[model samples]
Target: MTKLQPYEKRPYRPGVGMLLVNDGDLVFVGRRIDQRAEAWQMPQGGIDEGEDARTAAMRELEEEIGTAKAEIVAESRDWIYYDLPPDIADKVWKGQYRGQKQKWFLLRFRGQDSDIRLDTKHQEFDAWRWVPLDQVPALIVPFKQVLYRKVVQEFAPLLARA
Candidate 1:
């Protein structure tokens, strides 16, 4: 048997993130209710046991934005991973995970702006807006910038056709 690297010892949380795009090709981003800084992110959440990534993505959208009026356009070919900053790693997930390995879905929003709601029962975001894809990296927290960039790159072609 091969030895496990230190980083490999800590499990990554399984999660899903949605890149919901309007007819204008602008992506949806939300201002995190828990964050005081200018931190904004796409809808994302942990996948529960026995839940498929796509189902989890839909559930997260309903849970976070209070709507499921979107259809999947494409899914990331591979899982994208991000490590939380050390300061917050131990604080999140009850210290069980170092970060997340997420399957991202690109979705086309079929609903109007009024269909988007931020006051879900579990409200994760306080405010939200549709933004150009390029601006996404700069809008998110520093630790997640790289992951956001990769997601943007992976979906740019499909987004261009949107």
Candidate 2:
């Protein structure tokens, strides 16, 4: 049997992001608990070992936002990445990660707005909302601006259909 290798530090952490859009074309977003001012972002989290990206995305959506009433509509073929600025990199994830490499998905939200609950076992956000997809990049933290921009561009077509 091949021996397991020691974990090596990488510049990007493996993760997934969810773009849950409703029938009205509004996208789900939340204000991060760790930030004040303007740090709203879509639900996202790390992918677990042995988990596929699509499953991970749905799991993360439920884990972060307390709902799983969504269906995958589109997925980005490439892994999108975001580099943490020094100020944030210095404090987040014990400084072990430089940033995140994410597989983003466009999911159609099937539940009513009242179904969302942020008081999860491990709460990541203070509040949540369904906003216009184009407004996402601006609401997200600056580090993820590029990732959100590309995500919107790629998934915007799905929204147009709704």
Best by lDDT: 1
Model 2, 21-101: lDDT tens digits are: 888888889998987676899988898888999999988888888889999988888999888876576567766677899
RMSD after CA superposition, every candidate = 4.0, 4.7
TM-score leader: 1
Per-prediction backbone clash count: 0, 0
Could you give candidate 1's per-residue lDDT for residues 55-148 as a string of tens digits?
9999999999989999999999999999987658767776677899999999999999999999999999999999999999999999999999
- Report lDDT (CA) for all predictions: 0.92, 0.85
Q: Per-residue error at 133 for model 2, in Å?
A: 1.1
lDDT of 2: 0.85
